[model samples]
Target chain A: MNGDAYWLGVASGFVVVGVVIEMVRRRYLRGRFALVWILLGVGAILLALFPRLLERAATALGVTVPLNLLLFLGSIAMLIMIMQLSAEAGRLRERTRVLAEEVALLRTLVGSADEPRARSIAAEDRDQDSPR
Target chain B: MGTRGRGKVLVVVPAYNEAEAIAGVVASVTRAVPTADILVVDDGSCDATSAVARAAGARVATLPFNLGVGGAMRTGFRHAKREGYSAVVQVDGDGQHDPAFIPQLLAALEHHDVAVGARFAGTGDYVVRGPRRWAMRGLASGMSALMTTRLDDATSGFRACGPRAISVYAQHYPAEYLGDTLETLVIARKSGLTVTQVPVAMRHRNTGRPSHGSARSSVELLRAGCVVMLGLVREWPVIADSSP
Candidate 1:
């Protein structure tokens, strides 16, 4: 990578790290999930600072170019993040189902408890109407 | 057994849009177990299931949306636990599960934490055919080997749960579709609770649509298989051994 490209990568990595920290501080991102973002940021910073390291790894991995190696690693990281997100989504879905069920049960119980009174009042009205 | 001989029993009926059958089912359960409290959990039925169930002299717990059988049952279990019921008998609201066998289930619960009403224990005409039957048999065999006990019908929802089982399930019940029975048994057994099966005959649904018809059985089987696999890989809490 060129000097300008390397510096741009380093800056972008720092920005990513800063954004993740801000999210964690604001409680927008959970600490457990933020760790992944932080680690990715740090890895990006390390790779940007050591372009030779990427070249050596690419050679070891039988990649034709260092850029291809970077892309492969990035894709793998993206895939892992997607999997983690999907797992979290599944958990949230289950929790939502439970909460929805609880709410429905409560509504039914309260609603039915009042239903008898309503029915009796309606019956009384019907009786009066029948007399008329 | 009468109410005096047993602790408080709550009969939980999880129904989904079974207006045509809910009333009769509720009436039958009430007639069979006069002392036991009956709760019909209407799972967001678009029909008049909640109203019909209420009219049939059973307490109705209406969900705002359909949460499937597992979700509905979890709500019922929570209610039972909150109300301090000593045992809970789960009967389907489609008029399928026989309320007459409720006493047998409760009796089984005296020696076990969970009592499941088996439909194919050489007593009932509840026949299982095609791929669904094979899936059920595979699940039963797998669970039997895992628990080191014989389970004839692992998919039967006509089961009774003691206080221990109720409390555990109320807190940690799986919300997977059609996987509740198998998952509950696994969880109960792993928690060191004794699980046994009682013979009970089941009739076909009298009204409304069957949730798992012949067309959807394959999809249900696939989903159930995935849920079981997920349950196996998930970490489960190990309660203290409470079996007698």
Candidate 2:
């Protein structure tokens, strides 16, 4: 409604955000990423104070969507999904690297002509009276 | 450079963790090819394979680690070359390859530079057991035909090659993917050497199970076929005759 009413909401939101940002900083978002989140929080505050001013900056960044209500929720969801996918990809990539190393070691250890365990045995062994 | 001991053929057996069958195989080979020396390339067997091979009197060359089948065979060929064996026959440590048939392969090698056994040349003594093997053998036959300009068996592991042939294999053996032997057959023919199928007898292995189960077998055969087809397309001469 009014600027004071918005500030009251903003103050409570900051407390909630401070907790979330701590989670992101200490565990999820670290280093430069935490700095990016801080910048985003500062930008949100700047837009709250001068709602019409930062619209030019957002326009320059090619952000066309409405920063309020439903459109904002959609963008937030999209960003979270991208983060989840990126983390999963990082884990998968690490696993693939480990598997590749294992395969290489096996290739080196097992000489190329692998006569699988069975292919190496005789009919005599199968017959019970093993070959002498 | 030349054939060893005025034509003393050296058979190279590449074995990995084949302790159970190594001694029996060594004994059979020695009994079968009395004069020919046997060299076993033991690929870091966790079991007693190396000890058994050595005890059976095969000159066991221990690789520090497992180098897969291609590397083991290559190592054996290197030794075979040094030992002056005019020719090298690769026999598996498993009893699947009948050593008695080595002479038959040698006889065929008299005229041809490289002779490989054909499991489905259509006239083998024993039964192939199930319909799956029958089907696989049929596919292998067809694959051989496509790669070598109409040959009987391309998947046969039992093969004999002269020094010229051995040198080529020792150099370009594909280490990673298994079942790429047909590539060698094609390369051998292209290298001005005749690649022929020697209809020697083959027996089933008595020990464990096949490394490639039915599903893996099918997938591997398909992959091998595609790779071989592509390779032959690149290397197959434009002209027309097939028999080599």
Candidate 3:
């Protein structure tokens, strides 16, 4: 947009890259997931350094407004990242449910062993279970 | 696996905050299926559900936190699998499902691997109206088409599972809302388990009111529809005849 704006964009891009690197160094963000943000930060720095590149690319794609193209691409990137997060959450939920089930079942086995009737029933079950 | 002939049965009652009704439910189930073992899974209730179920002379498996009916039922199925039970019949801890109908359910297992206790199969006076009824009808029709057999009440919680059904459920039961009823049926049908429906009347709850209402029913049904759709397209495990 202007010289001051270009410098601001470049500085902000560097800030983003520095924060991501720091998070990765502190083990707060995984390297695999941080790679996307690192690339985005580098792309922002390059675009700020050469503003004509974005306008040219937008024009080649038949977009009259370069900023609109940037916004559109940004939205798609956000949606993709959000979808990945949701999928990861679903996997974690499934694993947690399975762990809860296993813990409950294990507790039952140990709890039943303390009672006499359950002991006899469990023994009978073990005897009958050999065929399977 | 065809019948209850020489096969041990386990009644899995999944309870969440049903301390007031768990005892009576356990007692009735025991009276109805005296020969069968009873396992009441307390789904992390804040009340005395686990203690009450344990006091009722039924074995209790207590989850560390709430996992809904599907999770508790899966826990029960895993226990049955490990303990060598040949069949499992699920009775709701709310006392809505009549335990006396359990024999009829087990009898249906003679030909099918899974038997559902249908409320609208021309026997029960249970009625539903408005959006809830429409949603249930849509699900029933969709499931009927998928299973290639009539399923009058696809959302019925009362059900019986043979050895094959037990094995399939122990591995892939969904913990999502309505997954215990609708998704489990889809999984069973997808896994090659023959499913049948038996007419049974539901009783009124002994303690609390039903969970959802007219306003929430529609939203929950929409989510449930997505669950059934996922169940349809999801890759299911093959269920081999495990009973020799």
Candidate 4:
């Protein structure tokens, strides 16, 4: 890569690393997700700083083109991230369903205990709603 | 709160938008099992199912959103566990299940932890056809082998669960389609609870339509296969190891 392109890659990598760290610090992003992204950003910086390392990795992986190697690794990383997100979403949905069920059961318990009081309050509300 | 003559058994009716027939269902269940406390679990119905069931003299638990029958039954089972009930009988809210057979189901529970009201056990004229029938037979045979007993209708909604089955279901009932019936039986068997079946007569639904259409019956078969496979492969909690 040319000097300007190399600097651009390194700068973008630093930006990505900084933004993710800030997000984690502000509690906007969970540490588990942030860890993957931070590592990705650091890898990008390393590859940009030492282009020879990328060439060697591409050769070791039996890829003739270094850019193709980068693209393949990036694709795999995205796929893994997406799968992790799907798994997290499923867990969240299950948790939400459990919470909703618990709420329904609790409401039933409270409603039964407060039935008489609730009836009188309902009666008062109906009385207030009626035209004078 | 009114446990006047309420026995240890609770009848849990999982209802979803069955306002038209809920009152009648509740009434019939009450008439059949006067000593058993009736609980209507309103599965986020858009209609007045909860009010109708309450008016018909059954305690109602209204979910905030629809979580299907599995979620509703789990709520019922958990409530039964918390309230110290010894057993739970599931009666469908659509009035298809005859509450008169509830006594027979409960009686079966005397010898087993789970008693299923089997439709094809030669009592009911309830006939299923085509792919749905074949799928049900496949499930029944599979469950029979697993439980080491004959279960004519493994997907029967009408069932009575003793304390052990109640505990197992309260914690691990799957909210997926067919899970409330098929997977629940699998869970019961996996938990080392003995299961048995009693012949019961089923009636036509007073309201609402049947869940499976001819076109969808094939899809339902595929879904049932997935559910059974998942239930068998998934790790389950052993009742023997769990804290009492």
Candidate 5:
């Protein structure tokens, strides 16, 4: 109903999204992220009902719209994702180099197996024992 | 091309059913450099490969069974090392690689660790063919670029090895692997030994098409690719000199 209350609901939404993203990235706040999301969703509903908390929080925080808060939180989450992905890519590259070397070594083994060395002693005996 | 020089250089020819061309190949090498002793690794050929090579003045080391190209070459390299040759050049028995060019490779070996014959290097190529052949040559060019070393004929079995390479190659050559020849280069580099290729012309195979098998198991091509890539990752060559 009131602009203040509507903006308050938006602020709640921002804090919740930010916390959720942070928790997911860190992999530490599994239950807390869920709890926060629910609490913010409920707060959003309450703001719609009361229509006054928005005015209070907006005036308190000196912010204008509720949407900006949500955008800011998502941006932080994205930064975290990018950092993690880069690390993963680096690990995969190291693994690829390792596999390439292995393939090279195996190929070498197959090529050398044919080189003549020695025969079994029993075969030598067989040749010696044979009648001329 | 193992240039840790002292004794005479020995050239190893691994021939299978190459009876027809053995004499010519041997004659060329002997004529070019009379003192260079040649050994032929006759890989259980039913044909007269050994006799012809022997007739041409090459001592034959017969393998009771056919041990493929890598095996034949390794045996020859081993014999060279055991007999105490100053260096060894692995020449094919089929007459594809030139014996006349042996001196050129030897010349390169004076400064470089290895001398490789490039089939497409300059103005030659009477016989290396097919889409697969072109593809292999292209891959080698790219691999050389990647390794930061210019290797035009990275897959050539036509090579000259010195004492350093012989000592390492004699131990483990992956003789069963078709592409083990290329891997030896990678191994040499990894072991911190210098392996540089010299430009030499490659001619056509005098006899027999050494089967590509299937497009799937194109042994020669696959091993070529594998060796170059492995060079980057391996800590060093499988040189026994590294161990404590």
Candidate 6:
């Protein structure tokens, strides 16, 4: 039963690593972000391949259950990932604001002149039509 | 007259859905400072604000979408910098900020890197009341303590930036709501720019709804206060002194 669980964990780790690799290859994931996923995948594989390492670390850390220790560490890692993503989101927001501002300014430069010229032409036409 | 020897001054008016008042605002600025170049940054207004400003003899930089006031002003600053403007003056398109005070702001810039047009400096007819007034006073005092400068109106958008400020803001203006006033000051001070305020009168908006109506004024006050506090903790890059 232990052997089966160990093999299942190894398989899941490999699957996660494989998906991340595929995503990187397809340009769906950036390298900086892929580093986190790859590290998580490798850590999972190492822990699965050597169950004793997890048990020993859990015991040393005063965690009564190895599984609980694993869950706690995973939660911490996820929390860190959440923080990193939040920072990235803020940077993206700033970039988006800059892009939006640039687009607005560029649009005005490109299309704003035509409207005023049309208005002036209409004004000239009115002037010609007037009694004066 | 002090602005005579300086380079061209670009008046940057950021407008968002301010069609009714934009034309009059542009015309007023033109009447006040005939030589100063007026650039109305239309922040993706769904109204005829861009057309109206353009017709009023003001250059229009129409954003593709609504980027709020902060984004709009940044665009104007970038334009001013690129066009080699030596100074940039910000005026609200809502007509609340009188263009008659543009010269005063420009004159103040001769002695300081940034000149803020303060409405509460015992010169303006405008009066602040209610919870929003309390919040403004708190923020003003807080920022004054933080920067070691007596800032009468920290939230005032009627401001002028010299060449140094224009470049600094062009590169790194805050993109947050109400950032043009509060965060920009923090940034200017952080970069070692001298900031001062000039007394300027303000008029009430002639048309359209004010950006922060009474219903949302308190909420906006809270948000602005939070942003100012966050600025205190945020790390800022130390820019080398480049004032001329």
**Residue pairs in clash, model 3:** none
Worst 10 residues of 3 chain B by lDDT: B1-10
Across residues B1-244, which tens digit of lDDT does each residue of candidate 5 receive? 2333247798888787788988888988888778898877776566777667766877777665555676666676666666667678988877777677888888887866667766666747545456666666776777576545777767678888777777776655554354456667767666655666666766666778765633544565656566666655655545645221
Index of the highest-lDDT prediction: 3
Q: Which ten residues in a row have the lowest lDDT in candidate 1 chain B?
A: B1-10
Instruction: Please write out the lDDT profile of model 4 over residues A1-132, one tens digit for every residue.
Output: 788999999999899999999999999988689888889999999988988998998999899999999999899999999999999999998898898789778777787667446445434543564343
Better of 4 and 5 by TM-score: 4
Clashing pairs in 1: none
Off by over 4 Å in 1: A1-64, A108-132, B1-6, B130-132, B209-226, B240-244
**DockQ, all models:** 0.32, 0.03, 0.34, 0.39, 0.01, 0.36
The candidate that achieves the highest TM-score relative to the unseen native structure = 4
Alpha-carbon shift of residue B167 in model 3 (angstroms): 1.5
| Every candidate's TM-score, chain A alone | 0.78, 0.43, 0.80, 0.83, 0.39, 0.79
True contacts kept of each: 0.69, 0.00, 0.74, 0.69, 0.00, 0.77
lDDT of 2 by residue, A1-132 (tens): 487867974675576468658878579766655665566566556556565654665576677743644357448956986897699787775454334323332433454365344223422232453322
Better of 3 and 6 by DockQ: 6
Which candidate, 1 or 6, has the higher lDDT? Answer: 6
For A1-132, candidate 5 gives per-residue lDDT tens digits of: 567866776677666667766776787756644565556556655655565565566657776875555466557866766786688787775454333333322332344343232223223533564343
- Backbone clash pairs for candidate 6 read A104-B63, A104-B64
Candidate 5 segments exceeding 4 Å error: A1-132, B1-6, B127-130, B213-223, B227-244
By lDDT, rank the candidates, best first. 3, 4, 6, 1, 2, 5
TM-score for predicted model 3 compared with the true structure: 0.86
lDDT of 1 at B51: 86
TM-score for chain A, prediction 4: 0.83
Worst 10 residues of 4 chain B by lDDT: B1-10
Q: Which pairs of residues have clashing backbones in candidate 4? A: none
| Higher-lDDT candidate of 3 and 4 | 3
lDDT for each of the candidates?
A: 0.80, 0.66, 0.86, 0.85, 0.65, 0.82
